[model samples]
Target: MAEGLFGVHAAALEVRSQRMGVLASNIANASTPNFKARDIDFTTALNAVESQPGGVGADLGGAVKYRVPTNPSMDGNTVELSTEQTAFAENAVQYQSTLAFLNGRIGQITRALKGE
Candidate 1:
């Protein structure tokens, strides 16, 4: 489990961070003349990451399919700004937590290396 996490945790964190950024952008542009709301299918992205050898992070060139709107806005706006912003905030918190754990793991490794 530790090995898997050590390899994949970073990938999960990165994907989540990417999702947060996209969601935040969507929210920020919500009032920008009919922007349509965008969302990341986190489940799909996670699955995609898990399926790849060493996880998707191993292949930075690999493309993950986004949850694009099947029904786009008439004004070419797809961002539902409020929803995106809320999601962004939530994801950011999660990202921070994940980072904390990853950092903690690194700290533990450092201590172990020092024979602490």
Candidate 2:
């Protein structure tokens, strides 16, 4: 019952959290030479998680792919400051949203258990 309650949102939260780390890494490496920006494909990851049992951490990052920069850099660095920052901010928001949803679900479950 607990497992059913959590469902895909739980998996989404985990993936979003992991994605935050990846995005942060991209932002941090923006100026580093030859550093390539990378991100996780959330849809693919979510699908993978839903398809298999005990799939929370099962190849969670197998869908990680490199970002294609809009502007080419001479230093061979793929991390663009603007792009990385934007992606980071977006990912952060999504992470927060997912956390909020999970929190709400937990609250509902708690209330139910308490007969509220």
TM-score of each: 0.71, 0.89
In candidate 2, what are the lDDT values of residues 36-101, reduced to their tens digit? Answer: 899999998788777777666757667799999899799999988887788778888888887888
Q: Model 1 misses residue 70 by how many Å? A: 14
Point to the candidate with the largest lDDT.
2
lDDT of 1 by residue, 1-116 (tens): 55454766777786787787667677677657655555666767766667666564533323433335555666777665555666778898888988898999999889999999
Q: Cα deviation in Å at residue 55, candidate 2?
A: 2.9
Candidate 1 off by > 4 Å:
1-8, 32-35, 54-76
Which pairs of residues collide in candidate 1? 34-77, 35-77, 35-78, 35-79, 36-77, 36-78, 36-79, 37-78, 37-79, 37-80
Candidate 2: which stretches are off by over 4 Å?
A: none
Whole-model lDDT, candidate 2? 0.82
